[model samples]
Target: MLQMNDKKLYNDWAAKTSDSVMKRRPEINTKWEYEDGVVLQGMELVFNKTGDKKYLEYMMKSMDLFVDENGNIPKYSSNEFNIDHINNGKVLLALYEHTEDERYKKAADLLRSQLTNHPRTSEGAFWHKEIYPYQIWLDGLYMGSVFYARYIKEFGEEAEFEDVMKQFTLSYKHTRDEETGLLHHAWDEKREQPWCDKETGLSKHYWARSIGWYVMAIVDVLDYIPESYEGRDVLLNMLEETVEAMMNYQDKETGVWYQIVNQQERKGNYLESSGSAMMLYAIAKGVRKNYLSQDWFEKAEHIYKGIIDEFILTTKDGLVNVNKICQVAGLGGKDKRDGSFAYYISEPIVTNDHKGVGPFILASAEMEMLYEERK
Candidate 1:
């Protein structure tokens, strides 16, 4: 029952976002970073939908800040071997394909080279970063795997599929709580990190955004993985199980999710925006691709409305903003994030963070498409 104005929601927000981001690109970050990729990637989708050259221009202009004409990323260091750094490669890949710019390809090549020596666990999962040794984080899967799959599709060998599959399978196997089917934020393979359980090697709590990142990774990576690939079914099964588990924990009243996913009754834990948007995008995309049943559409519709009502806002300037986003969360950093319920809920909830805005736009795009097709 979407009104005509409802159909324009996605485009309006996208247009406002593109302009807002462009105005602030200089201050967004100093180095080549992942948050830029998150927002630009959403803008890429908007570009695809509307054929707006300005969206593409904004993406290229933002990236040019880091990528020199010689194709070197000025501030990026491969030696860091940080999986988070690889997230931007998705946008680079898009730029290379669309504009056939060699600089973009060479920049992407630089990121690809990092995985050549990126630290991995004994079972072959990429460590979250060189600093966090022997650890696999759910967030790393999205940062690394999506670009890895896309790179393999464009310029890699058939043998690379094994490496890609291991990232998803190994991360899921190690961190997933079998009973609940929800993954903890991270796992310390050596069980040495203070944040992890000494015996189980798993973190203490189920963080909604971490699980959200994991599910979003699965659906996005599936794009470049061929249907006939042997591991595709495994990824699909994992997606279904994780999404179903997420549904079981969704706030029935708000139709969103809590910061500490399973501890809904816990005091101070509130509904979160970024994670909810991530879930909406994954479920709606799954149904659109026919990987999920048609019956799931109603649920996707519900989530879309819920995200709109619970988190969206309008500025006095007539632009949109996403609020109530957990600014950041992680396990076992210098501050020793213990992955407890308090740790997840204590992060500053901010407005219009890229983590929330990008996913909200992506979700809106999916809902827009679904509405278009139904008409």
Candidate 2:
């Protein structure tokens, strides 16, 4: 599989860390940046694997930078209820489990508080943003649902499970294409957005990373969703359908998914890292949970190997590099993102990017666990 030496690769990946958690800020300090959560998620796995407490301490200290002794997060507003903001809840949950810290619990509760007041459509789908009215994005599902499911499980909030189910079902109902079984990037309920189709609630075309987010969310949330819940089977079926649909678009040569999943022939549409890692995680976990056949696991293993060989770079400094990460994807906005093949390819690709690195670390952790189980 990964020809690069394992010890050397580990050393390289570990070298990327900074000495103090408080010192880790984005090189280009932009709001809504992806760096902290990405590093924390990756570090969580690394710590679990190696039992190195420094990584865990780094995560706790970094989170402490945002959270105060009183358990309130600094510079965070719950009124916005943007699902992207909830991603860090995973770290909180981990901290609570490991350290039994009340501060982490309070910080997670703050995120849960947003769910009570967050705007939702009549069908129970969360709006992607307050400013972007009546829109449900594929990206939002992974962002919020994983945290929601974990919260519900941790606190015995069984009643909220229905809301979780409704979120996925409504999003799929609006965005799923009947013919291709692929989902659009976002759906505008008002159909007022220029990117939205008049007849269907769908955005332009199937975006690979968007679908990847949904796939990863479904599989992850299923872990905590009670097996007896009526809607649980529905989610499993959705995951199965999504897995089948995704397999059709995977490049046979590279064993990785493309930027625009269905449009491989179009110029500049290359294989992407985040989506590939997400798909690998979903498929491997699906098979582990017995929701999918063993055949899918073989495919996931193949793709995982492909990612290591093609996308990952081992720098001289011994840090792992995730190359060819699409910076961002979106629908209607001030900028024109038509969701065309060319538009998808036009996004800048960066090395050692956090977007891809977090998911890659997660996928690798799962694969390593599976290998251990088999052994």
Q: Score every model by TM-score.
A: 0.96, 0.90
- Which residue ranges in model 1 land beyond 4 Å of their true spot? 1-12, 23-28
Cα misplacement distance, residue 13 of candidate 1 (Å) = 3.6
How high is the CA lDDT of each candidate model?
0.87, 0.78
Model 1 worst lDDT run, 10 consecutive residues: 1-10
The number of the candidate with the highest TM-score is 1
- Give the number of colliding residue pairs in candidate 2: 2
Q: How well does model 1 score by local distance difference test?
A: 0.87
Give residue 45's lDDT in candidate 2 (0 to 100): 71
